[model samples]
Target: MTDLDAETEFLGEWGRFQQQTFFLLCLTVIPNAFTALSIVFVADTPPHRCLVPAHVNLSAAWRNSSIPLEEDSHGGGPRPSRCSRYRLGDIRNFSDGGLLPGVDVNLSTVATEGCVDGWEYDRTTYDSTISSEWNLVCDEGWKKPMSSSVVFCGYLLGALVSGQVADRFGRKIVLVVSIGAHSVFATILAFSSSWTMFCVIYFIVALAHTSRTGSAFVLGTEILSTRVRKIFSTVGGNMFFCVGYMLLPLAAFFIRGWRMLLLALALPSFLLLTLWWCVTESPRWLLSQGRAEEAEAIVRDAAKKNQIEPPAVIFGPSHNECKPERRKAHNICDLLRTRNIRWISLTLWVIWNTLTVAYYALSLNTSNVHGNKYLNCFLSAAVEIPAYILSWIMFRWCSRRRSLFSTLFMGGLFLLLTLLVPANLVHVAVALEMMGKFAVTTAFSIMYAYTVEVYPTVLRNTALGACSMASRIGSIVAPYAIYLRSYSISLPYILIGSLTVLSGLLSLLLPESNGMPLPDTITHMQDFPGCCKKTPYKLTQTEENEPAAEGKCPVVS
Candidate 1:
């Protein structure tokens, strides 16, 4: 009846089908691409608009990629053979456009400046109305941003609780719960009657969504074979982001209004929840929870289904394994010891939070993009796909520390570009923004993998959870930095840029972790930094470290 028992019972997914389903279901977690700081922008397509100015040209703005209805727009008399329309309705015409779903618009220009000044086209609502009724503003509208911030706080709180929940309840049950809650909460937000209601629903949505992300990642990482596990885990985050990006435009195309958009996105979580009923649970978690008997049953079932005999190996870590640290019993004292290990861990956390704050805050508050927010946002996402692929390839060739620092370097350089290039040069700014995103995305991917590598096994989850919490804190600070006061306050970006550059310097101070096995015990932890090859690590029991610790590590590196 204990969660540990339930956990052990579920890990033995011997059947190939069970394994495949478990692995495949990870795709369900990938829709977080539209996760800008939660102020749902007006979709390109509005609700029903009765305004017909004698012509209905169908071109998307430069920021949008939808094909133009040039004939009607550019005085070609609505002929199909006419050149494509380059613009859409002005802000004055931003009323509801009838819900007719067809093509997706991928470009918008205006103040976004992806296009030149004269071509600063107005955004047209492209798709159909999402729902019968939508609330443009929740009551007590002042709380919208705070309501969204609740999502970040939810993530922090969820990370704090997730380790225990997943351990006690079992990841499968936990995932199902999170999935169900996220769907329900998000769906309710669509029908929110007041600001209080929206805030409450969004808070629930945040909690569920946050826990789901944690569980899904843990599941995805564990399901893979050891040889491929680390790389695949990193890739999972990267791949899902691309999928999420595509979903954004699709949401734009189908859900014309905010409520419809929210509801449509919410449905997918429910679909994922339903899909979970048939998928097998993680055998690893089950084993950890001590439900050996149930774990065996699942494996036996898997063996029968796959038509392959089960291996004698039990669901336990290999002897060569440096068992992961378990620092999750809630000791703030342990975290604040401010010694080498804890401090390093906290520094990494700060780095992560700073990066997320600047990255998402900027993306969310791109107010200058007047014409087509959809296209501007979409293009930004498209640029991120390569950033991930490149990270995988390069991280393999270079040490994690160097690869991470280089990415930071690139991001800082781009941030500097944003500062120096001046605002009037919109195209240059857009290019710089792409460069900045590319760099940051790469950094984001690598840091997650590297942070895990740096920590001892027993403390891994606690360490990571702490880092995630810092990231949330940063997330909170980032939005207000961009959205409040002088909204154009470039200070956030500048500060972010400087911190990132410092992070690169800090990265240089850390020991490189190429080809090194993870150190699992603190008894083994303090010795690791100076022992790396290239900066080879070796220690004598009598002394804290040897002369090699003080010298340039011989790269056994």
Candidate 2:
């Protein structure tokens, strides 16, 4: 065990203070879940057709027949064209002569034109969406995906900045400020008059949202003991996010308007700001900053809540004397300075990027599925419950590498199975998609704990932030990947599945960290057990003979 863990062992694991912090910190993720994937419902493009002007007088039958039939890109055979309509002048002349369209003139021979006036949307599913409000269809369809990409662009910036800020300041300050900022920006986004304005405000909201999420995860992990960290990281953290995910469809189902739904999602973030008083600053972070007195005060308070007597000297002489060394500033470059850490960082970047692409692609593709969009989205979020539970079980007993590899492989296999399911069995295809969601969700939950264990406390938040920034590249690509469904229905699934399996194969090279103590410094990092041999540090004969120097190497094996 690390010296810090040994010093704080008197409070026991799962005390009142730890339990309260875990619950409150996990609550912060709910708003993040709402804002992260709200684009699916906000920008949904419903069925639409060209508008027939009232000036061209015609019977209801003739007006209904104005649009020509075209082959459905989703494989439902010929359907009414969404972007074009029969030349209204010709149709009007035919109606005046009392001749019908298929009876006298062939629609195949009739010339078609783009919607000259405007478009009319089918409001059966959504009463109003950004696509319907701003007419983001036909030639304007590219704007819809661009809006989602803008949010992720903000995520990229936030990840790069938040990590360094939190590591330099403290976790609690960042969490409070981010939560408040997100709530304010999200409220202003509801009043957007144009698509350009909405995108700008939405970008700021996403930046704050990402900051809030990363800070909460880091704070919760630092505050809790090692034994309890696994539970809080996997089940406690992600399950709340699942709750918000499930709640989104229910809120959208009732509101049916994009603006009001955004307001609903935004208003709840104010409630999370109350956490500033209830949550305590992380003691580990304080000690790392060379504030031993502040760290001791928090630890003693935790002990008081647990009803245990506090030790007279909580930090001891070793921690007090070594304060100068622990206070040194570390940056992102520090993650690449060492050999084992460099290998781990590069591998994690690939794994994070691949998982993000697959996860968001499956999530956003819910609208393209055969069932009701609301029900499909709800099922997708609901399946995460069992996935998280299974993740907790694996973290309790299984090796981190094996658990990540198996879950990712299973997720890819289920996605690939969708190709074999026949078009006639729509239910089977939906089931396979849900199974893929379940497996990927499990792997995602396990990844947070595994990443935390691999890095030292000093660079933990920075490493996570950098990895998150890299993952935004995948998120930016995910919407376009879903756009591939326009060409072939199975195309998105095939791409996401292939990448997921490849990532699972790469994860085998990461060192196992299931039961190891949290590394306090870069020198204490764990080595790759089977893939790479550890290089021992050179020492003098007298120093090597000492018990403290006997097994101490620059890098642990």
TM-scores, all models, native as reference: 0.70, 0.94
Residue 96 CA displacement from its true place in model 2, Å: 2.0
TM-score of 2: 0.94
Q: On residues 9-60, what C-alpha lDDT tens digit does candidate 2 reach at each position?
A: 8999988988889889988988777776888899999999998888779977
Pairs with steric clashes in candidate 2 = none
Q: Write the per-residue lDDT of candidate 1 for residues 1-557, one digit (tens) a residue.
A: 01222222333433465456545555655655544422445312132221223244532332232233323321326332112323334321321342222323223441121111112122355332211122222132234456557667777787677644664566677777887887777778888775567667777777777677666665554444443445554665667767777667667655666677777776776667665656667654444433445655666666666776655653432211312232123333455554667656666776788677767765665533433666777776777788878877766667877787899888877877687775467688778777887888888888877766665433545566667767888777765665452434466567777877877767766667666554433433442233345532344453333212432211100
The most accurate candidate by TM-score is 2
Model 2 / residue 418 / CA error / Å: 0.7
Q: List ranges where model 2 is wrong by over 4 Å.
A: 322-326, 529-557
Residue 408, model 1: lDDT of 86
lDDT of 1 at 136: 22
